[model samples]
Target: MASFHLEEDEIEKGEETMGSEPEVDEDPSSSSATWGPPHQHGRRRVNNYSGGAVGLNINEAPHVNKDSTPFCVFMLYFARIIRLLVEETNRYYHQYLDELQDGPSPRPDMTDSEMFLFLGIIIQMGHDIRDRLKDYWSTAEQFAMPFYSNTMKRDRFLHILRFLHFADNNTETDRNADSYDRLWKIQTIFNTLNDAYEKYYNPSKHLAIDEIIVKFKGRVVFRQYIPKKHKRFGIKIFKICDATGYTYDMKVYLGKDRTRADQDVTATHATVRGLCRCIEGVGHKLYMDYFFSSPDLFEELMTKDITCCGTVRPNRKGLPDDFRRRQFRLKKGDIRVRVRWNFTALVWKDKRDVYILTNMHCPPAEGSFCDEHGNAIKPAIVADYNKHMGYVNKADRMANSYSISRRTWKWTNKLFFHFLDMTILNSFILLSSCDAKLSHREFHLALVRNMLEHAARGPPRPQRSRGRPPAVSSAISRLEEASRHHWPTSSTSRLRCRVLFV
Candidate 1:
């Protein structure tokens, strides 16, 4: 319940007074201030406590170009992943058709090449599938041809949609399962992409964990209503991303069962633990929002050699009573610091109280920032958290900007397209990290172009040359001779007589 206040005199003196206090716990097991050995030699250490900067600097980060071909970076990383999805989809589609009893094949079967084109069309044309298909069939433009072949009809594409499934039919199992348990439909695909994501890139320090909502109004039991979100109703996904918006890991939120408890684990703690499981013992520092930050979670991360930083809600358990109490007397730049056995909680009063919790940072000797008025101060931990916490949000914004997802009655289809968008977004992040100088739109365009070009059957045909019309040699000679020989009496009659004679 105790808290230590930082006075203006102490701030002006630039003294490190918080470390001297007995309340600041020095337990090696719980304190994140203590340094540990590097996770691996030559591994780039993310912001460490010596006031090291967090996240990547755009100018100084390493440049790695895996392939020189346009969109080769995307293909190199995601080609196999896409192929797997297509194969699974086709397998399930055929199985579904064969199982049908009443109708004459519920839908037509699709080939891998056709499926690739379908996805490419989605990337190239961000519209309703039917409208895009209509345009593809009706337009005279060359760009439209690569997206949908001249031979392909709109009905065929619709058939593909009708039969698309990521998993096999198991009505018995599905019917017996809970309504929220339908995530098994696409679980394999999700696992495949996740594995590829982690294996392809090693995340830098300063990772962020946050939720992403894929907007949907479909009939589903697990549909969430987050009024604050732009799309209030959708399926929720928890994501852990790095500084450049590269998703290192993700977990779909099904319901309360998404978190499994061993003893006294909270949902927030369990979610963080699940997302960060792969990166444990690697000395990575994770940043999250108040929803996931807690004293016990920070302690848990510290044990695994990971550092944690985030804003904490005041009402959360384990927050000191003094820290929680409303402060009307505190000025704009006033600060408070409370160091527990496991984590440090900082309260800086700017326009309002901004509370920060971290196992990675300690109280600053001199608060490192000034507001526009030059009178208000900001904490370094606050600044650092603000800088890195937006990575997941950045990923979300980029994905949603030119989303290829369409309005669908089926939540599963919406979820599938959402996955596709995330896949492309992740590829963009990876490519940009490797020094590919392209925006998200450019990356997607290049991917579409590459896929279409590669799948093309043959080179485009050449246009035939148009030569001059055959010369009227005989007629010209006759006309010249007639003109030389004849000076007619009546001009019109003479011309007619000369023509007849010629």
Candidate 2:
């Protein structure tokens, strides 16, 4: 091998003398013992040849100064938004507690206040936080974005308080933070959200129920209860989403105990009933999955004048196959009575062939209404019911197909993160309610495109000086002048482009 070593003095002298010569490529066959070139191979070089003060004597210099600004101003704005929301929520919660208990300030230290506030904000904003980010940050921030919303935040805070035994274990509990416990804080956020749904949205006839699974830190091993199927730990989240996609109610059923009794079915039912009581109407509907279906529970809902719609399992033997076929019959107006549907079937539990059970009865309408594919449809309500059932079946299938490992925190975070992702999807649904012209999925796509465009068109940076820096006022003046010349023309061009695209 050829001797490649060079003295420090020789290298410095070579740099000085060879300054004017074109920079040579790094040697390709350097031994593995040597570090790779400082820069990547086959890359263009940045020439900072402007040696004099305030002027470039040569033609080339680095394209832009790296330190002038953050890579994403959009992300900064989102962080600011998260901060603002947390501060505001804490203010409201503390105020509410103050009125009820006649107490002094809940949390005194500013740092403690901020940390809990962040926890509350993340859970309350659950998934909705991601929506705000979709319009600003790239996919990286989206992945890191917290699962929180106004309701979930409050719920988590309360759950933490309950776990610490700082307050009464009731819906209207007012206990605040006692100490700094991380897991307590996390659990409180979820539990409080569940209570909020019971208090505000559950009783109303307009609420619907869904379940979410939140992964945890370690494997759930149980001696008394049924050990969780996968070693991975998770909390089963029961959410009551209103027609608008906002969570009115929730329950964080710890997944460690898989026994039928420990699942807290009674508490979950009571919470659902509590939510239903909030709505001021004679007839309301509560949508659920097959897991919640029971003879007594269905009868209880019927007695309360609240209708329940969900999948009835195959082995549910009270109603026969012949009865189901007869019940599926359609009728015409005047002669047609609004009979409840008894949707129970033994077909495979997949997206394409899942069954829906409802108490409402109706005559099937075939030709009057058509699906998107122009196929003759059943009654409009029946079609809607079918779509909803299809979505639940699909979600269940997707959840089953995927499994997370328990070996790392990254895996745990990833599972919970995916569960929180529904908040963005739900927000898109809410936006669609405001403007019927767009679907939630379509709105998300548009926002993503806009965000990418903004990121690619990164902000311009200020130039660095060799000697004394320019005065602040002088720099401001230059920026103002640039703006005056640039903004109006840019705005007009953008408008023209939008018009053409439309």
Candidate 3:
């Protein structure tokens, strides 16, 4: 684990824009005037990757704490974030009670134990799902779940969820029709969790940055529509996760208004920069897709002592115009390389052209062999990118496996669930990487069990359900509380006093 925020020396250098990086000769591959000593066919053949990859050592180096439990790891991230949840929820719940109720308060104010139990119930829902929540409380043979009923009343669960709030609504200025804050409601929670994510654990050097959809179809100004993705339309979250599926950092896409990168920087590039700020100058290796790969970025990262590799779009700036040559193409297992400064651009031919940019890998040893089906060799950079680029995807898959998320009309609510799921995923990763090797489902079960059981002994049971007449209330309450003699239900067998005076 490491500090969530970067200190003085680790802060990201000035944001890099193509215009600002000192210009070099025409990209080596852009020209054919290569009668040089070391350069090759309109390019150069060289490799200088000194930074060795470092991953978390579950039992030793990286996993500083060898003896860790699932609940302890869970608290590392949830302790602070839950406080925010408790405070705002209570504040908003009270405000809601005062505004909506017709007479005196109908329900007691929300308490900490009640809040935790509420969360435990929500977490339980993901592990065990029913068509309707009420079914968990049903007395019918198939529908009855004593576990759910014993945990909390279904109506009380629904009531707390109905008023669950992360931010106060009583005093709000900016979130309106004109100049609205898209993430105003859940902003505090998002930031608090993001901080915990960063500080909870230091990810391995091979980190990946990618976007995952929250699968929302609700009305929103900044909703994304990625046709290729399964959940193609929803809020997009750009996160950097390690090989273990630990989401180290994340930033929600808030459309144009929240775009705060350099003027010339593309939104995608800016996102990568923001997510990478924590690991800057740490000699980490970043793996990303074509959406974020570019020569300028590779070089910029190199300057910070970090190295990276990823697939790149041929049309990206700083690439040779004919980087993806049409007239001349290499056969299967053959590749062409171009070097500019410390960054290398490679094009390998398989079923189709694969363009890759990197400063972390050398070119593949040249050879002609069988097709991909035959498991022919590929450029080292290509293989490395393919291997390490799935960290974020892995994180997404695990989060969705036993998700606490639910369909909601409000984008904030949907995002809140996404955060909840990610937090649990991170905690699972943190614990599993150390001592607990529990499955994603099992970890959640244990987490929910501990959280509920810890706070499960709720306030003492009530003696009366409703008030009696004003004059007789006190006397009737005292008489009802008198337990010297018991009123028993009729039964076939009568109990004999077993206690003996000693």
Which candidate leads the pack in lDDT?
A: 3
* Residues 1-502 of candidate 3: C-alpha lDDT, one tens digit per residue: 1101111111212222320122345443454423221153233333233433332233333434535555667777677767777788778766765564233435656667777788888888897777776887899998877887888888788877777788888556665455566777887788888887776576776888877778999999889776655676899788998888999899888877443547777777777777888887656878877767776677667667667777777877777556744433677656666655545676667656677777665444444645446544555566567678888878888998888787678777789888888888888776665555588888888888888766857665333235323335544555567863563443322343323322
Q: State each candidate's clash count.
A: 0, 43, 0
Cα-based lDDT at residue 408, candidate 3 = 72
| Candidate closer to the true structure by lDDT (higher is better), 1 or 3 | 3
Residue 459's lDDT in candidate 2 = 41
Please state every model's RMSD to the true fold in angstroms. Answer: 18.9, 33.2, 12.4
Model 1's number of clashes is: 0
Worst 10 residues of 2 by lDDT: 13-22
Q: Cα miss at 331, model 1 (Å)?
A: 2.9
Instruction: For residue 8, give model 2's deviation from the true position in Å.
Output: 67
TM-score, candidate number 1: 0.72
Query: Which candidate comes out best when scored by TM-score?
Result: 3
Output the worst ten-in-a-row residue range by lDDT, candidate 1. Answer: 13-22
Per-residue lDDT for 221 in model 3? 87
The sequence of per-residue lDDT tens digits that candidate 2 reaches over residues 214-283 is 5555443211121433323454555665445555445444323223343434444554555455442355
Q: Rank the candidates by lDDT, best first.
A: 3, 1, 2
Candidate 2 ranges with C-alpha deviation above 4 Å: 1-187, 196-206, 215-217, 221-234, 255-282, 321-355, 363-381, 387-502
